[model samples]
Target: GGIITQTPKFLIGQEGQKLTLKCQQNFNHDTMYWYRQDSGKGLRLIYYSITENDLQKGDLSEGYDASREKKSSFSLTVTSAQKNEMAVFLCASSMAKQDTQYFGPGTRLLVL
Candidate 1:
């Protein structure tokens, strides 16, 4: 059994600033993903990595970048912080696209 941890549980950023978020998993899964959950919206994919050094952009990847440094870690960087309300960013991992995914608690970010 393994765990996933996200750094800086709460992130405060200025408008137009670029912020980076980190995620580390010990599950050694084959796939990792970054997702954004807005105030009143469902989860939207930002990016995903199928393996080490692989990056795939998602529907919401316009404002974000992601990296899979190793089999156990995946990170994301926000290109530009917007004036949107608070939201939670979730990290997930799966054996494959068709397999069940496990999610991390989330990183809450607020743009002031």
Candidate 2:
């Protein structure tokens, strides 16, 4: 078994600030994903990478950027933070898109 680690745990930002969140996994999975969760809502996929240096934009990728520096790491950036907003950003890994995904502890963000 392996675990996924999300850095900083908490993030505070000002309106319009660009914030970055990071994730790393020891599972050595071939695919990694970034998802955003709003209160009372399901996760929305932001970005995913199938392998090192391979990037794919998801439904909610318009205001975000992602990078897969290596198979074990993925990172996401909020292009512009919105005021008085809060959300949890989750990281996940899977052997294939159809396979079950293992999630990391989320990074919570609050914008003031």
Candidate 3:
């Protein structure tokens, strides 16, 4: 049994500002991922890390940066936030690339 936690449940940022969100997990999973969910929209992959110090950019990684500073933590930064770009950032983990993934509650971001 394990749990994942995301900090700053709500984030308010200015347009074009760089905002960061953090996630932590204790599941000892090998794969961690960051996804963005727009209002009423499906999940879009931002970035993923297979292991500590290993980074993989996903389909939607153009405006985001991700880090796997340690096995238990992953962080994401929005390079340049856009107006009306409110979305929820979700963190997920999987034992393997093709395994079922567990997701965090998500961090809501509102760009003003």
Question: Which has the greatest TM-score?
Answer: 2
Tens-place lDDT digits, model 1, residues 29-110? 8999999998678999999999899999899899788878898889999888988648999999988888988998899999
Q: For this target, which candidate reaches the highest lDDT against the unseen true structure?
A: 2
Ranking 1 against 2 by lDDT, winner: 2
Question: lDDT values of the candidates?
Answer: 0.90, 0.95, 0.94
The whole-model C-alpha lDDT of candidate 2 against the native structure comes to 0.95
lDDT at position 102, candidate 3: 98
Q: Is candidate 1 or candidate 3 better by lDDT?
A: 3
Q: On TM-score, who's better, 1 or 3? A: 3
**Considering TM-score, which of the candidate structures 1 and 2 is the better prediction for this target?**
2
Worst 10 residues of 2 by lDDT: 36-45
Write candidate 2's Cα lDDT for 38-112 as tens digits. 978899999999999999999999989999999999999999999998999999999887988999999999999
lDDT of 3: 0.94
Ordering by lDDT: 2, 3, 1
Ranking by TM-score: 2, 3, 1
Clashing pairs counted in every model: 0, 0, 0
Q: After superposition, how far is residue 83 of candidate 3 from its true place, in Å?
A: 1.6
